[model samples]
Target: MKISNAHLRSFRNHNETAFEFGTRVNVLLGENGQGKTNALEALSFLCLTKSFYASADATVMQQHGTFFEIKSVLLSDKGKEFHVRVTYDDEKKTKKFTINGADVEKFSSVIGMFPVVILSPENSSITFGSPADRRKFVDLVISQSSKSYVENAMEYRRIVRQRNMILSEAKGKDCSSEIAPWNEMLITYGSRIIGKRNQFLSEFAPYIAQTYLDIVDERETPKIEYAPSISIKPDSSLEEIAAAMEQKLAKKKNDELRFQTTLVGPHRDEIIFSLNGMSLKHFASQGQHKTFLVALKVAEFFFLKERCNETPIFLLDDVFSELDEYRSRKLLSLAESLGQIFITTTSEKIFGGAEWNNERRKFFIKSGEVAQEPVTA
Candidate 1:
């Protein structure tokens, strides 16, 4: 799917702005704080039904405005079109995500329809940052491709929250029986999450390894391993996994009461990134960290495409500056395999004039405004 047009109102610094796009490649050029990244974030909203970076709807709303809206049309390769819109109200803290003017019941229904892959500087944290960063990366990829996974993951988080509340509320001994229902719920939901996470890692491993090697052009083998808080027996069935989770949670009851938190589950898992059998965070240089991050995104693109059976809209959000000429060209060339790409850059000269198609529309964004940037050789 390709975004044909995007209109943003009161989002970030953008009070009102709209721009049409080319089918293959669309570039946004501007200096810092000129709304270049905001445009891409708007496009991400159209696809993902929320801002890619902002944690809450209010964070993305313009400081001077109380509400923000993003509307766009997505065109399929078969010439079909989908009208998508996302709106947020600050006072109510409400968001409306819709397609064809019909409210979307859940984000899962909206995700696979307009699959997206985003690569930005912040993604570097996936390599050098905490385990939560890597887990989020995993969830975003798997959720887009599988609706069942989405439901299970959401339910898992809710159960975790409820369990934590019970832990905090208790003030006496032997509250294990009080939290019993929550433990069963956790087993029910957490097992599914862990199972799906392991399956995704199994599918995504080779792709990441191959892509990382190609990006770094080095001999070191990159590996991604799922280290779950609950051990998943390879020989065990789903029922057996649930039983194991229940048993483990029962065993950790004393520790759970002592700490006032649920300790054993996928919520505490980690995605270990290693090269040559050593942790990437400790052994890799800054440049190597950046390369590994891009490789993960590139692998995510292919992973979603393979699972969803459609090309996902790829967003490169001003990350070209992190790479040298060769790596930048490598990224662009890899992007060419997909049907549509959106790039935000501060320097128009990064990719060079010859690299962009004359028909590939380029836009200059400034002060929340977007207009066509003329293509000249």
Candidate 2:
């Protein structure tokens, strides 16, 4: 899929602007703080229904503005067109999503409709970051690719919150009986989440490994392993896993009460990345960390493509400026062969005069206005 046009109103520094986008290799070039990233963030909001940089919608709207609006025309491979619009109201503190001029009650239903993956310089440190960051990374990718995974993850988180609330209330009180129902709900949803995560890792590991080798030029194998809350053999049933959770709850009841939280579940699960039997987070160099992140993102693209038969839109936010010449060339080459890619850059020198193919287009974004232009060497 590709975005044919976008209209922005009171978004960031933009008062009102509209521009068409290329189907492939659309580069947004401008000086720092000139709204290049803002354009990319606007496009991202259409896909995820949330701002990537701002925590709240009010922060994304221009000062003194009451609301922000983004509208896009998307064309699918089957010759169908989808019109997506998102509006943020500061007074109501709410976001509204519409598709084809019809309001969508639940944002979840339209979240992955036009899947997108963003590779920013900030994402380069995901491998060296905390386990929570990696978990979110994995969850975001899986959630976009699989609706079942997203549903299970949402349900698991809801159950966790409810269970923790009950635990907190039962602290120094006699409300322990209420825990059973929430525990059952947690296990029912959490087990599916864990199972899906494991399955994703099983399929994703080899792809990442191969991509890492290609990018890093090393024969040393990198491995990714899923670490769940409970140990269950590969062939074990969900019922068995739920039973194990029950035993864990019984074992940790006193601690859970003391902490007033649910301690064991998919929320606490982690992913282990190792190279030559050493933890990558602690041992890998900065360059190695970047390579791993790129590999992980490439694997995400392929995984979604293979499953859905559609390539996801890629957003590269000033990542090329951080990489050396060789790495940048490799990334540019990889992007050239992939689906529609929207890239942001503060300098045009990074692209090194790569010619635009029939599918490629370039845009210049200044003060939140986008204009189509030829990329200069």
lDDT of each: 0.84, 0.81
- Against the true structure, whose TM-score is highest? 1
Q: Write the per-residue lDDT of candidate 2 for residues 1-377, one digit (tens) a residue.
A: 77887899999988887766767788888888888888888999998888766777789898899999999998775758999999988999888899999998977777677878888876755787777778888888787878778778777888998888888888746456888888788888888877777777888887887777767775767888888778876556778878877788788878888889998888988788888888889898877778778888888877776666566888889988778988888898897688888899888786666666446666777776764455434
Clashes of each: 0, 0
TM-score of each: 0.94, 0.93
TM-score of 2: 0.93
Clashes in predicted model 1: 0
Candidate 1 lDDT tens digits, 137-191? 8999998999898888888899999989889888435686778888888988888
